[model samples]
Target: MVNAPAEQKKLPSWWSGGSVVYQIYPASFKDDDGDGYGDLRGIINKLGHIKSLGVDAIWICPHYKSPRVDEGYDISDTDIHEPFGTREDCQELIDAVHAHGMKIMFDLVVNHCSDQHAWFKESRSSKTNPKRDWFYWKPPRMIDGVRHPPNNWRSCFGGSVWEWDEHTQEYYLHYFCSEQPDLNWENPETRQAIYNDAIRYWLDRGVDGFRIDTVNMYSKYLDFPDAKVVAPETPWQPAGDFFSNGPRLQEFLREMRKEAFSKYDCFTIGELPNTPSLEKILSYISTDAEALDCTILFDLADLDHRGGQYPLMGRNWALSQFKALTAFAQQLAEPEHKAHALTYLENHDQARSVTRYASDAPEHRLTSSKLLATYLLTLSGSVIIYEGQEIGMINAPKDWDIDTEYLDVNTINTWREIKHDAKVQNDPSLLERGRAGIQLTARDHARTPMQWDGSKNAGFSSNPDAKPWYRVMESYAEGLNVGAQEDDPNSTLNFYRQLVSLRKAHKDLFILGRFQLLDPGNDQTMLFTKTALDGSQVAFVALNFSAEKQPFELPIELTARQSQLLISTLGKSSESRELDAYEARVYLA
Candidate 1:
């Protein structure tokens, strides 16, 4: 087998071609100035750590001006940074990320804005307001002389989508929280204002691109038809389908691409809902010139176990399911559309992948982490590494709870309604189950303060007396912090560092190569290899998902005399070796 290049190669031009993307949850990364929340400066401080991980870029969760209704997803102004810092701080953070040889992608939440935003407040003030059409507003239906909501649409936050405005005797639609009103993209002025400010804000700040949030929800059906209702037992709402992939979504995205995104050599990844069609994905992320760089697909998110009755699965980590899903995604991403699909296992809204997919066995956490990394990075597409995945962090313990005062609106309302409905139905178990599901689904679990150390509060907040925006996972106390991991070569941290170094060392083979999935039908394992155009093949990725070692063979015919085990979680490897339980290996081929 060929030896991996010894020297560090120049940053791959194909990094923009499609490479690793790290998702950073702003509130948990680090606290600057003892604010008890991560700020731009905190990210700035960790640039070296991020660079060390071998990610080509980062996607920062919103730091935009917001009332924190949905943890900054509720935008007040796309142009302004929130109390997190000034525009200058954002610029500095962008510069720092670039300085570390990593690009930065800002999160763009365009579907809705906080009620406190001046535009929303003005639109709600009067029916005669000039900007009344800027948002979805309709006269309240006078049913039996009592004002009623305009339509049957339900808010994803579990209430009427329309909120009554006493001053104007009108109701406005909000897809998420009532305080975060949906914008009327049907109105050109509204679209233009959002586009103009948002595009300039980051481009001027030197951000490499944007991860467009809730992109499919930006355009709504003008008719606002009632969606097919989900059964009461399931929390799923039909109303989402009515607006999730609206007719004008592509039109809006096209305009977004043409006006703001297309002008520069920027990368754009759409956080699209549903599994968008291949044609759609290609149109959105194709290298052909007028589209986003890639789009994060929900293939993995939709692979949850179904209780048989629901449209989607409940929660079961099946290797077969993961294999099938990833194979389908890879087929779409293959050598031709390599830059189109953004490969990711989990994000802020989903349960942590290591905990969910890897089974979280202490003995197997590292193995599972390596398996997942091998499966994701070797695929032919852009890759997004969710925060904390590199260190093998598992989901937080279920015992943790978000007290009412500390909960964000979306989650707090969900907790309240689930409990309220359970009490009405005299079903205590429903409430308990709901709590369990919340624990599994809460973004706060992942957004919790990063495990910096074993110190009180995990060394996230400067003042020991201060409280962080979210609880820190107990793994910190158990010695899973950066300070501890950095010193241990056998730690998960070093494994990731080595993984990055290998990719950097073999830039041609790893970064700009053609990827081929070795065996797509194997459920108990994953195998793939990347080959550069010049005939140099640097690595082979293999993962064992079965609890017991399962025999498997490579699909490709290898001429190399031997394969060197470059990195592995099993701690030992050879040219021809069996993978231990949940073991993952990257071999020089």
Candidate 2:
């Protein structure tokens, strides 16, 4: 670990209490060098724009040295990638972010490393190599003189998790893609190297903290056992039960906290997928545990998922269901738990919230977007806003054919699988249905370049002749561009600004207050009240989720006393009990 004095920068005690994070997909954010890809310098250029959103921190997606497989998640090295810029550029970005009074969080993907990593290369060189234990390698199982994989585990991308090396005559486990091999965290040497070389390397450079990628999947069962087959026909099956939140996850986290994180005043949040239970989740972030500051659980994101499969298409969720889920989430983060909550509506892995939760119809789109913003900002937790979310960006145009136009690896793989299944079933119509599914849920929808202006390539790059690395959304010139909304008082971008300002102004009422759900029986409306623990402050937020106006009656006791309208999407006096379609109102009661 680098013992830099600058790494010990002091942080406020209230840093985690009421902070807002804005997530940036670096490659799609901007192109400063005109190389058709976003680089570190591009992020430096947009600091002012991000600062205008009133976010406390920015969570930059992985820009580490990689083969661009899985969009930089497959890291060949922990250093800055050449395409993004040199290590100096990264340090400048960090310093620039701090200058704006905002912190920066880097994406830390340590569950695995690219097969091309030096350690992985050395491990694969020979069976007797000293670094052979750095990765999981097992002898192949032989059945009737036929060689087969040691177990039935499957890779997340597709196919078997084990790949046999002809030269080494052994199989190495890779839960993700064959190009990415799972690191042997069980080895003390591997654990120490990751902490000393990678984690401290960034912290020493003035990074605030990390959003730990797949934090719960660090450990595995000692025995390489077979996974239960959930789908017999498919080449890949769900093996998360055997690997996700594995046996030694908490132990390893505590070790990390004591060894690396404890050295500096920093923030740490984990991208924990497939977490088993609410009790288990609380343990990870609970103050008593001291493992992590917070975690992003996928329970809310999977609300409408089909059979809990993230890639498969799912149905629209009801307003009542949304209310129930949020209420449960609030309960989990109750003050008694003394745990930090990382709440968000959109991120790099999911489609835009405007398209997922709100009606995309032109007439209702703006109102729905505002309604979701109110819910996001008013919720009692630290909030995260994805890039382009403030400007009301929608999913990629419905006409952009997934087979030809989309470049997201996840979308491409899922589309191919869907089409293959359709062909095997001899149903041509399924191909069209599969296309629609991909259009609705593909991660590409969120990967489109940021809409900076109405210019060609959406002003993401200055070179007029340069094409973006990914397809820019077709709706940019029509009004979704940032330049068009900057001056408009009623624009979605302005609405987000106002909402964030409101949250910052009333940190005690919105951030430190206890959240209580109201009118749980209302299926077309969601209502909640945030009240300070001492009962000195209280606010009620009402949302009309349906397409038609709804009548709402305030509690008799509340209406008996005078109440002040704080904010509303309808931009009208909040005296009436009737709410317009997609209306959201916050009242100081």
Candidate 3:
């Protein structure tokens, strides 16, 4: 247990109430040593930029040693990766973020480890090994003359979740790629190791908190039953029914809190996907619950899709649907709940939000970016802004080659599978449509390197000849880079900066207020209000989701004389309540 030093007495929790977290996908953030990959050193240098954003915390994605099979989530060891720098560099980052008056949250991916991890190595060596039970190793079932996996569970990357081990003559379960094997959380020793070695290790290193990756999947259905048939196209099916929010989930989280988290002055934000309902979420994050401080919710992110987090599965979302979800989300902000809502639109695992949620076309991109930013900032929660989101980054251009520029494992597997399905079905249009959908929803869109300037490499790396690990959005090199937007008063980056400041000035309304989602059934306009719990402050927010102008009236009997204009995306306050294309305005009502 690492107690907070007297000098850092306030470190116990700094992420609640009006705190905005700036998420850094480290590899794509910035490269300090001309290595073409962003690292801890790069983040250390960018501390000023983060502090200037008016954010209180920074959530950095995985930097641990890995085989790079799943973009660093397949961690091999808890040690800092050599590519990201050394353990000392990580410590420096933690200290640097503190020195800049911001807390740092490390990405904790305890759901699985790389196949090359020492524990996995020892577990797979022999059936009698002490660590044999450290990972899920099950005997294969014999069908006819051939051996088959224990069940029809599918991996997140789209295949059987079980991989056969030749030497052991058995199969190991992996919810993701075969290279990333699931740790046996059912084992007490394994759970202890995760808490003592990984969770507590970073806490002791002085990291302010953690953004736990896939926290809900730690426990599993002991029976490993065949997953229900969601897609009959293949035998393997999504095993969410058997694994998500498993029976022992709360017990494990309570134990985790007692074992490590509660002992330290830190916070934890869980990556909790497949949430059944708001009630389920409240159970995880409510003040009385000994679980997560906050959870990365997906209700808003999942609105534009049929399948959760899977690419090429697209669906058109109604503005009413978006309004309903946000309204549903507001239940967490009630005083009775005492739950801190961790809200976001973009993250490393998903595509850019501006492209998915709003118009990203050149004509509407800027206005819509501000519109979405307004929506995100005004929500009664701690907002998380993805890297490049402030400058309005969009999806990868359609002309870009999927086979070359795109590199996410999920994107690659889905692309190949769709190509095969298209060819077998002899539908060229099918392939074209698949390509378009994949391009539109690909994770690679978020994985693109940061655009800092108009340099050859978008100023991400010092050496112009050193190519970034991923492609930079070429169109952004000119006007959309930070260097350009930083100077433009009306730029998306500046607009975000303004909103952050405004939110802080009125934290009572945004942070401790009761949210009332109004006109939720309106297909074109979204209107909401956040009133302080003590009724001291009231904030009225109006947004137009459509590209064309929309007429909106305040349901409440109010006029320009009764309200104070705070800020507007159109850069001017007007007596007219009519909303322009993609316009957003907040009023002190």
Question: Against the true structure, whose TM-score is highest?
Answer: 3
Per-residue C-alpha lDDT of model 1 across residues 1-589, encoded as one tens digit per residue: 1112223322233346557888998878888868687788888888888887877889899888887878888888764455477777877787777778877888887788899889998988887788889898887778899776776766766677888878877788888888888888988898888877876556655777788877778877788765555555543444655767777777787778777765555677777666447766665556563556667777677566322222222465666667767656665555566445567877777767776676677777767777777666656656788778777777778666545422656567667776777888898986776676666555555676788777888788767667887767788766567877888877777777776666667766665666666667777877777777677665677788867886655444344536566777767655565777888877776
lDDT of 2 by residue, 1-589 (tens): 2325334434443356767999999999989999888899999999999999999999999999999888898999888889799888998899999999988989989999999899999999998899999999999999899898888876666668899988899999998888889999999999999998778888887888888998988988868787676767664566777768778889999999888887776789897777747788888888788798888877778665544223545666677788877887776557888887778888888888877777767788789889999999998778889999998888887878777898877677667777787789888876776676677777788898999998998999867578889989877887888899999999899999999999989988888788888889888888888887788778888899888999887654357567788999987786788889899999887
Record all residue pairs in model 2 with backbone atoms less than 3 Å apart, i.e. clashing: none
Residue-pair clash count for candidate 1? 4
Indicate the worst ten consecutive residues by lDDT in candidate 1.
1-10
- Model 2, position 444, has a per-residue lDDT of 86
- 1 or 3, greater by TM-score: 3
Clashes per candidate (backbone, < 3 Å): 4, 0, 0
| Order of models, best TM-score first | 3, 2, 1
Q: Write the per-residue lDDT of candidate 3 for residues 227-274, one digit (tens) a residue.
A: 788767667777765768989999999899877787666778888778
lDDT of 1: 0.71
For candidate 2, the lDDT comes to: 0.83
Error of 3 at 251 (Å): 0.5
What does candidate 1 score in Cα RMSD to the true structure?
5.7
Clashing pairs in 3: none
lDDT to native, each model: 0.71, 0.83, 0.84
